[model samples]
Target: MHVKDVMTTRVVRISPDNSVRQAARMMFDNNVSGVPVVDDQGQLVGIISEGDLIRRTELCSGTPSPADTGLAPDEIAAAYVKRCSWRVGDAMTPDPVSIDEDASVTRAARIMHERGIKRLPVLRNGELVGIISRWDLLQAVLSARQDDLPAGDDAIRRSVLARLGDNTGLEGLNVTATVSDGIVHLWGNVETAGCRRAARLLAENVRGVRGVVEHFPDPYPR
Candidate 1:
């Protein structure tokens, strides 16, 4: 499914001019770990997380001793920006990673995994539309499973094939599918681990799929 289907539209954002204390309070009151930092025109410029706030000098005894950091003079100057920064723009990570709202949730998951980020801002035409977090993806998985499978095993099988075929990686893969009593059985050969995961997620995302059993044999040896 697309990010728009699962992303949270009621996003809380902070301005670049806002104070770190204000940003921290906003996150605490909203119970979020991070927030998008926007410009005066509401354009996304950066992100401020709990990690950023916790590193502030006010919370960490003003500044680290030169001996403690052992940093070069230039490095020390750069570190000072982080230590002394009180405004969101100064402390926030600039040019943060973002995703299009119409992109697949799998793509979102992959980006978050590669970046080691907790959340992603969903944008459309260069404007913030919503936000998706690890929690939101988890919720999507749980909710997708709870949905009732479509009536008839044939219908289920067709749906499974359709979903897999929709993915370009699985488009030419030799995949077979069968469904009985809402449980899907997938037997296939894929070129890569990503394709294997693609097959599984495609099946799992289909409504009325109670369970999926994959028997995919990878062609490449580890």
Candidate 2:
């Protein structure tokens, strides 16, 4: 599978100048843990997460230091709060590691692992196309399993489950597939509208998927 096959294209974005509080609100409202920081032209510049915002609060600072590191929580909080006052451009990881849409899902997974990151922005023709998270990789892997196994009509059902587990980390996606001559009928609730789209795309990408009967609900069950 390709990175584009599982990325969330309709991204939630915030301006660099947006306050940490505002960013947090956006994340909460959208039920997203992070938002891409973008410029006026919607160019992806960085990313901000709940951890970044929480780090700025005096009361919500880090844990108590170990004996080896003699640092007060307040001291760490003070520094973080100070940086939070600046625009995201000053604090966010500038020039984030990104992947091309055509890149394989395995490559995307490798990049995330190497960077110790959960997400990666997808680029196409030098422009932002989408973003893929570790969840996406998981879903892709699940989808690949169904194609690898050969079985009866019930085979597609297990295939869909595998797809759900692999392509997305969303565990509750209820999958029911009816395979007749390798044609798949898919039904399920995915984590997000993006995930629903990804599920269908992966089904199509799989070999012997004659057609997909999609009944995936948007804004999947939490």
Candidate 3:
């Protein structure tokens, strides 16, 4: 699926001129963790997340003085900005990671994971069009899963074992399958990637099977 299929189009965005306090209030009111900061042209410029607001001077006291930390002037200045900045332009993370609206869901997932971020701003023609969150991706997966009919455990076990024995051509392989609550647990050793994929496919295609749990052994080093 594409990001556009799952992204929330009615995004809550803020201008760079907005106060940090106002941004935090918006996030709390909307129950969102972050908000994209936009320019006058409505182009995405940055993002202010909860992480950005957590260190505000208003929230905490007893911070070490710049002299006590023995930090360089530049480092001290940067710290002061993070603690004292009130506007989104100064407090937000600039040039935040974003994905195209037409990008694949897999791409969005990868980017979010690699960056340790929970959301991705979806852009079209360099304009913020939507936002995709981890929750949205999970919902898409669950929705797809709901379309599959549940198969009986006994039927799943028998059919999956049969397919593995006949179709996989993994001679002398000892693959066993057990099913409970429509989930198949496959345990075995496969010599090749194709064999592993075939085994999973067989189990997944079986009627009444809700999911596959593979417990294949680690392959010995060649």
Candidate 4:
């Protein structure tokens, strides 16, 4: 399955103007590592991860002052007590690595591997629609193990359609599906590139789908 197939739709978000403390609090309360940053009009602007926050702390104190050049690293870190106030624009990784909803899961995995990112932003028409993580892909693998796995492409097609029906989110997805070997092929239309990806993730979660190949119509408005 692809990143879109397994990504959660109920995404947590933060505004670019939101304080770092506020973003950190949201992550803490939601038990998430980061959030997508948006604008007043709800556009995907950037992403802030736990790693970014940690980097803030490191940079805030890790810088060696002229007077502290002789100090040990631990002592320097200890002496650098106050966190420098920063904006989302300052702390965020702008234009993060992302996937279109209509790309293959293999491609998403490959991009993540190449970029060394743990999660990928699912984009639709150049907007942040959702995020997918390593955990989501792992879940796709586990979800495919239940029941008697389909033995061939036709059976896999039937199994995938059944899953789309079962997944109401995917049921509303305007896409067609085909199968070859164990891979599911997706075509048709969606509201956004994000929805396309969501459709694929749904297919991945089905018990018989080994992988997904998405080639959907561009849902972006001209």
Candidate 5:
């Protein structure tokens, strides 16, 4: 699926000229952790999030000095501005990462994971069309339909064997499966208890599977 399929069209935005207090209130009232900062022409300029606001001087007792942080004078000054600035423009994260509306949901998720971000502003032709968050991706997962599997004991056995061989952690192990009356019987020389359990689960999850029986030799044989 694509990002546009799950993105939220109603985005709560804030102006760069808005006060820090206003930005905080907007987030609180909207029940959001961040707001996209826009310019007079409705162009996305930056983003202010709870992470940015938590560093404000009002929330802290004191700011760290350059000597304590071992940071350069300019770096310390920039951090000071982020912590003490009144305008959202100076405090917000500039040139924030964004995703195209037509991009795949997998790509969007990868970007968010790599950047350690919770949301991305979905843009169309360099203009903000909507926003996609981790929550939205989760909703898509919850609504997705499971792949239809073929019925019958033979199909179930094939599926179980294929699953075991297809990166199910039982790969390379001497595992075999037989199905009768929709019940699967797994046999193999799996050394680890985890792999044995994995084989059982792999068979149990296949469609038309009613029960799973393991016939592997005990690891702690006397």
Candidate 6:
């Protein structure tokens, strides 16, 4: 499914000029971890999240001095602004990662996994159209329809044999099957007990299959 198919169109946004306190309150009230930071023209500028808010001066006891960490003067100054700044523009993370609205759900999930992020802003033509979260992907999985399996004894027998020959580890193992009244009889020259078990399972999982009976020569026959 495409990201547009599952993404949330009703996104809560924040302005860069807004107070940091406002951003925090918005997140709390909306039950969201973050919100996209937009500019005057409604262009996405950055994003403010719980991670960013946690670094604020109000939450910490004190800021580490540059001399203690041996940080460059500019780096220390930037860190100070992030911790003490009141404006969301100064505290939010800039140039946040985003995904296109037309992108596949799989791509969105992959990007989230690789970046260790929980959500992504969905854009279209440089405009924020929606947002996709890990929860949306999970909902998609739960709502997806199950595939219709083959019906009837003949069809089930065909499916089992086809699966066994198609990269099912039993390929070219002299395996074969027949069906009678939804019951399957597996006949083959499987070398290992595992192979015999695999054949039985393959047949059992086929649609319309009621039971499986294996008819194979014992490898340990003396």
RMSD of each: 5.7, 13.3, 8.2, 14.9, 4.8, 6.8
- Best candidate, lDDT-wise? 6
Q: Summing lDDT over every window of 10 consecutive residues in candidate 4, give the lowest-scoring window.
A: 77-86
Candidate with more favorable, higher TM-score: 4 or 6: 6
Q: Per-residue lDDT tens digits of candidate 6, residues 1-222? A: 899999999999999999999999999999999999988777888999999988788988557644437787798888888889899999999999999998999899989999999999998987888999999999998886546577788998899988886456888778888899999999887879788888888898777889998889878889
lDDT of 5 by residue, 67-107 (tens): 43888779887888887989999999999999999999989
Model 3, span 1-222: residue lDDT tens: 899999999999999999999999999999999999999999999999999888777876637444438888788887778678888898898999999999999789988988999999999999999999999999887786533544577866877876665435654678889998988898877757787778788788777888888888666665
Q: For residues 92-175, what per-residue lDDT tens digits would candidate 2 score against the true structure?
A: 555778899999988898788888888888887767778899887887777776535545556555656666666365556665
The per-candidate count of clashes, in order, stands at 1, 11, 4, 6, 0, 0
Candidate scoring better on lDDT of 5 and 6: 6
lDDT of 1 by residue, 52-124 (tens): 8887888887666454477887877767786787888888988999999999998999899999999999998
User: CA lDDT, every prediction?
Assistant: 0.85, 0.70, 0.85, 0.74, 0.88, 0.88
TM-score of each: 0.68, 0.55, 0.66, 0.55, 0.67, 0.67
TM-score of 6: 0.67
Off by more than 4 A, model 3: 62-71, 145-222
- lDDT value, candidate 2, whole model: 0.70
* Candidate 3 TM-score, C-alpha based: 0.66
Question: Candidate 4, residues 1-222: lDDT per residue as tens digits?
Answer: 556778877788988777888888999999999788888876778888887787555455655356667888776664453234456666776777778877777677778888888888788887777788888777887786455566677877876777665434655556678887778888765666567777878778665567998887656647
Global Cα lDDT for candidate 6: 0.88
Better of 1 and 5 by lDDT: 5
Name the weakest run of 10 consecutive residues (lDDT summed) in model 2. 59-68
Candidate 5 lDDT score at position 72: 78
Point out the higher-scoring one by TM-score: 3 or 5: 5
